[model samples]
Target: MGAARVTRRGFLLGGAALLALPGTALAATAPEIADCAAWGARPNSRVVNVVVQRPVKILVHHTATPNVTDLSRGAADALARGIQNFHMDRRGWLDSGQHFTISRGGFVLEGRHRSLEALRNGRKQVEGAHCTGQNLVSIGIENEGTYMDTEPTGVLWDRLREMCAYICGQYGIAPTEIYGHRDFKDTLCPGDVLYGMLPRLRGEVGGMLGQRLEGSSVRAASWPVLREDDRGPVVEAAQRLLRGAGRTEVAVDGTFSAAMAESVRVFQAEHATEEVNGIIGGESWPLLAAPVQAGDGGEAAEAVETLAATSSTRPPSRVGPEQWQQLLTAAR
Candidate 1:
């Protein structure tokens, strides 16, 4: 109806300038500022004012339901600001509802300034609200979504994995600490399809943490090989994978046999990894094992081969300079 006040150039300038912050180096690359200026705005600007009353223990959230497709790098930043404005201006809240916000395009933005720093110290600090009661001890993360009955984009799922792992590691929060906003309240805020992936979300986060702990990147650690006598974890991993893939009917005995080796070969061929040799060597170790994801409601895990099929996104080898600036600038 009216001319959009924020210009793309303005967002670009804003995005470039954010790289100067102290925490930019540690955080992931942000979306383009120009992108942030274009997304649809939130309704009812009632800002809620509140105090950081307690230490954060977890992050919760719902999809804010902003309808748009073709989300550029900038939309993520725009969503963060819009949401912050909504919570502060519309909801009469002090700041954004969550400490982190993931855009539809998989961009992650910092809502509160001190959140990352506080999380790094693993000390008590106040995070924003997404879930009530738990808000006193949790960091809320609202994605640009309406999860009523829809599946989240692949990008959203990946970004959530990155954010969850980063926060959990920095704050000493476990995967069990991760929960959907509905888990605490009656509202199905995050929606069913997106929420249904919580178990996977937890696993992704756990997979991330395991990588950090194991001295590898997320992708690298997903399938790790045992160097020596650590065959127990590897053997167990292979058996589990074969069983999960429905290729072998092997018992959970911690021994590697020809049948297990054949299963591994089949899995390698399927994943397009090097053709599986009978020997489960270093190259084959990662394939045999499954990384742990945060379990949901105690359902038995789907098995290693199944996990390999599910965990498809690859980790970026190196962080680019321009992308880094975008992420820092998007932090509200």
Candidate 2:
């Protein structure tokens, strides 16, 4: 097989180019992927957007489907088709929301169009619809079953580890960059059990790629970093927190302006007392936001409900207390 002639900037086909992704020397082995056609995917409602940048992170999600006894290739194929239809028809997406999917049977299949090609090239990405605020920079992998309390099968776990190593190798991403869906959004996606297992997943993938995942944590949840120019519900959550903390000057708008940045830095100075970079990442989020439980009032409570209300297709308190606890745990 001819190696893709890939450069940091573009891909040239049918040349013996080095496939070692930028900033890494490890040779990535592309796994046997069942592309969209192989899984009998419906023609995309429209062309998938292929972005010209390597993804920096991997987001794991579960289909929230039943944990069935049947674990077969046929089931995997059916699952792929079902996902495409739901994303296209119901969610009104061009194709499946994720870049790839792993079935309970441990079959690895491509989800969105151009995703396999992008992976093979190792320097481009297909924009995903998986996480609202993070689709542009992350690759989403949907595991096949609901895993809130139950763990995935042994085969499923092994296959997921292999795929993560492959993706990390291909994209030159560190194992620490692997995160669960709930990290970025206010929803229970890659459920409790699977989310908790991410540290093990990162460690295993790092071992496979002969790489080190520095700064590893029990969960190492990657919250979307909010800078001055960033926008959306997470930013609003921060703003509301500031407003509630007596920064009456801060408005509960969904935009992260320069004033907000200064406010964040000031808050960090007063409370967090380190990494006063004015960015809401692992270092500052837990300090800025608090979890809201039943009948809770004040800005923290309002901010949690604001995130819930802002997220379409989820319940009123979809970004509920359980997920907030998980975030605080992982970030700390």
TM per candidate comes to: 0.47, 0.65
Runs in model 2 lying further than 4 Å from the true structure: 1-28, 214-218, 221-327, 330-332
Weakest 10 consecutive residues, lDDT, candidate 2? 312-321
lDDT of each residue in 109-196, candidate 1, tens digit only: 6665544434433444644566656655777777787876777788877777766655554455655566666444334456657666
By lDDT, the best candidate is 2
Which ten contiguous residues of candidate 1 have the minimum total lDDT? 16-25
How much lDDT does each candidate structure score?
0.50, 0.75
lDDT of 1 at 53: 45
Candidate 1: which stretches are off by over 4 Å?
1-57, 211-332
